[model samples]
Target: MKDLELLLKNIKNKALLPVYFLHGGESYYIDIAVKSLENDVLTEDEKSFGQTVLYGKDTSIPEIISLAQQFPMFGELNLIIVKEAQDLKLGEDELKSLEFYVENPVPTTVLVFAHKHKKLDSRKKITKILTKNNWIFLSEPVKDYQLAKWIADECKANQIKTAPNISHLLADYLGNDLSRIANELGKLKMVMKEGQELDEKLVETHIGISKDFNVFELQKALGNKNHAAALRIAFFMGKSPKTNPFPMIIGNLYNYFSNIIIYHTMHGQSPQVMAAAMNVNPYFIKDFAESARFYPLKHATRIISLLREADLKNKGLGANQIDDAELLRELTYKILNVDRLKVSV
Candidate 1:
């Protein structure tokens, strides 16, 4: 978040806050805030006496406050960070004890709370005080379409060059878990030369994703009306069901054509309008604009239906005769046929 970067800069400049509460589903920014405190809050000699880290399972909020009330020893600030604060065995009453500490916090102590995955009760007075004072940060998930742009930015932050649209390939394979994506990107960068441009081949080699046989490529083939290529990739998927499961393939297709269908229904809206309506990157509007020919409004609608039905079948709710691989081949065949004429599956 913008506030997070500002807070980090302030910490680096020794502009300290008495209390910090970082709660989020995505832990990337939370980790950054914690690391900033570790690196910038105290000197190497000061860290020996000025830093304390605790886990929620073993520490109480009252105990943490007591620790925070301690005076710094030969340092400008004493940093006490609490990780996984969500697991703390505390109810509203126990949490309220923090209100007193927050109201009259120690000048020498900087208390940081890394509450991962969930937020504390906002109705509580403690939450109200922290938020009003600008101490709480919630890390919202990156939008589904924004993942690629975020990945591209991350590549730059790591000093790695990436070929165009490589972020799209990574987003298609990795989903929107920023922590996991960073881990994979770190691995990919390790195997490359220092300044090598991250390409499809590098990703396929280091990240174990298929450059040619992934669902994104499958979608591209279908969008271009290349039935042979679509079927070929589907067969590759069939041979390796462990890696490419039916649900992920179906989910990707559902997202892919549903947007194309949205573009057609908008009926002559500008590319910018459709991009905003569909929450898609503006650069990809042309692909969906062209895709209207391969899968017209009527066919795109039916293909989504086929995908839904196949999803149910794979789940043993409607039908479960074939495995995911065979199910995918059938789904691809039906989608490609929708290009020729209206199809039913």
Candidate 2:
């Protein structure tokens, strides 16, 4: 799969391929590629007659082939785009027709398949042909652990300065939704002053995620065994169910303690080694080290069990009509005092 930049650069240099099969699990990159082809391939005057957009659900392979075979009416080339190509149902004859067209596509017509949210069937001959010719672009989803770096890269690409932890903060709040994170960054960029860096305060003000009271802060409080601070944040989070969903909080805690257990077992290793083992940034190794001191392997394992019980309770199993706030309070108390509570593993 070619990178989006390389693809756009090719189109910019007038080195256009006969066919572009943009299919993927991530729609953000796919949409960007499709838009670039739509706008960059032809001028406004040329697009009036040269450009044609078709939906996969409404068009067939034979129809696509027929269009691709035709020359441009008013411009030097014809640009044919098929959006939502994943929804295009294929039969035996249609598959053969597509494979035939891809193998010997028309040079004067540029055909693009904007297949979003899924990839082409690798088992199909057409997919193999696309790959062999470098015509396919696969936009794989970014992993949860990679979101912070992705955010940081995006900030850098936009020529924006940010605090070291700002990317991590945004990643924690936004999860792995590239489109939503990009939208929030776009909003921040609009209101940002000249030469202003994006810090936690700016993010809290613009993105609605509190600098203090978020899952990252709550994790810090728990890692250091600050009982008072943990309870305060938990209480605040419980009050705002929409912002801090109970299940997401529990899931984050589960991941936190699970990493602590891994850290305990990796003693004496370098920060980089441990960070790689835990899938966390090396900058956070010190924090994890402090957390490991507070939570031994046995304690961390037991806390994970406690988190599982809390998750079940949040799902209304054995909860006895307790509200999320109260459940959160009880769970926080148990986690902070795991040794004394003798939480079963």
Candidate 3:
């Protein structure tokens, strides 16, 4: 729970110690940590004299130490940043040397070890040495419950106000990829007035969600049994390359029907019980509930079979000239009960 503001303040004030290990699961923290060093640690003139960025896999500890040992050309200290330090060759020998260096790091140098993706093994001798001797900041990913708050905080930092639900919707649509989420939010920030609230329509218009529609959200609407809403989304998606990218669409379709099948199979179970039984998030139970209302176990099985055929057609089997848009529209009409079934007289 390290404070981002405190870290930024230390970087800007030049009050930070020489050695810093910024390793974490959250990309937002890792990105901010590195950028703060780049922008605030040294002046442009100081950077030209002593700043060096090195990749861990390519550069050994000896090489890093060699550079760190050198005095700044005309600056007070050198700044050595090791990106993706998890890939850096840090064996026993290197760890011993690094431990010693960290203990007595040159006052004329600043060494920053950045390990992104996941946390480095702090239990290791090298990591243990670092914790006892230098500044160590461990960043963890935001919990699912905290994601909306995190996004809201990010917007607030930029002096923008995002509607609460909008944040969750963005988080829901973007998945859990922090970098991608940040990119989308950054794009949204540009088009929004400073004090204006961001809404779903604003997101739809500016973010360029599939003009024709995407399987992702369409699945959500259908699962929730909002048939009308689902149909509208389906029609919109009919305008896009989504239908053209038949394989991807088919994949999503297959997953949706499969989940519905699973829900029906496990009907009469509690949300927790169903989630555990089907290996899905509990948050998805509502959609499954809605889907169960519209589809019996038998109908769910039939839809799953239809999706299987669609998958094959998209894969260039059976139908050689199956147009994605046409196939998808036909499927939508059937799914939404818009098309009447024919009976033998």
lDDT of all predictions: 0.85, 0.89, 0.74
TM-score of each candidate? Answer: 0.91, 0.93, 0.66
Candidate 2 segments whose C-alpha is farther than 4 A from its true place:
none
Ranking by TM-score: 2, 1, 3
lDDT of 1 by residue, 36-98 (tens): 998998888888999999999999988898899989767678899999888887777676788
User: Residue 196 of model 3: what lDDT?
Assistant: 82
Write out the backbone clash pairs for model 1: none
lDDT of 3 by residue, 169-240 (tens): 665556567778888878888888867887766777977554235665677666655677777776666667
Top candidate when judged by TM-score against the true structure: 2
**207-227: candidate 2 lDDT, tens digit per residue:** 898888888888999999999
Each model's RMSD to truth, in Å? 2.4, 1.9, 6.5
